[model samples]
Target: MFNVSDGVPAGGEPVAVTFAAVFVALFVAHQVGDHWIQTQHQASHKGDAGWSGRWACVKHVLTYCATAMVSLAGLAAVTGWCPDGVPAVVGMAVSGVSHFVIDRRWPLRWLADRLGKCPDWLERGGGLYALDQSAHIGFLFIAALVMAS
Candidate 1:
């Protein structure tokens, strides 16, 4: 877990500013890793079956999680304060697994198809991408909370 200490008087409760900073850091990490760091092959092949797709997704998520960890480390170095616990690890595990599942797109696609008469947007690949990213952002928030807690 990433520890984000805000130089607050140790032994006392943390300040809101610390959490806010961590949240911003994690969010930035998400954007950087998910968009900038990810390669075309990783983006397009994450949902493939067998080892190829699974490996791609794993690599992507590792980079994504590393981004978040580095961001938190940066914040800690600069602020000299951070949350103290395993929250970040737990959060990352949850987020990573969630990301892997969502990126697969099959489950969501199945649901959309089952619900028949779905909106055109929901049926498009772009919509799935949007949904996948939204889920990631949501998990990022959770990760931040884990760090802040």
Candidate 2:
């Protein structure tokens, strides 16, 4: 939805600026949704195998995805940089599913257990936490690209 004439590539696509703007907007939304909207209960109990934990995690992911989708849509409306129709939906689905899988904490625990050792800095989950956030950001980038596609 960006200005079609400005910085049109040889392929006649929108300028890179539009992509960058969408990426930044989505990233900000991700930070707010993951950190602010997520409840402590969902954070604490999501890894459990029980139904309550599963539901908590599901609820968290739903809100998180909604936040990202809304932010992306708003950005599109503001900047006139909307991508193809399916990309936004595909991006959100991928982002949300990946977020859910990573936040479940099973992979982190598996890595920790298999590593068989941890330095002091890595002891209190700094390592896993960083990895988790990194993965989320990576997914967000992909989602942004999909949305800008």
For residue 143, model 1's alpha carbon misses the true position, in angstroms, by 1.5
RMSD of each: 3.6, 3.5
TM-score of every prediction relative to native = 0.81, 0.81
Using TM-score as the measure, which candidate wins? Answer: 2
lDDT of 2 by residue, 12-31 (tens): 54556656776788788889
lDDT of 1: 0.76
Tell me model 2's lDDT, rounded to 2 decimals: 0.77
Find the 10 residues in a row with the least total lDDT in model 2: 1-10
| CA lDDT, candidate 2, residue 89 | 77
Score candidate 2 by TM-score against the native.
Answer: 0.81
Among the numbered candidates, top lDDT falls to 2
| Span of 10 residues, lowest total lDDT, candidate 1 | 1-10
Q: Model 1, stretches more than 4 Å misplaced?
A: 1-15, 111-119, 123-125
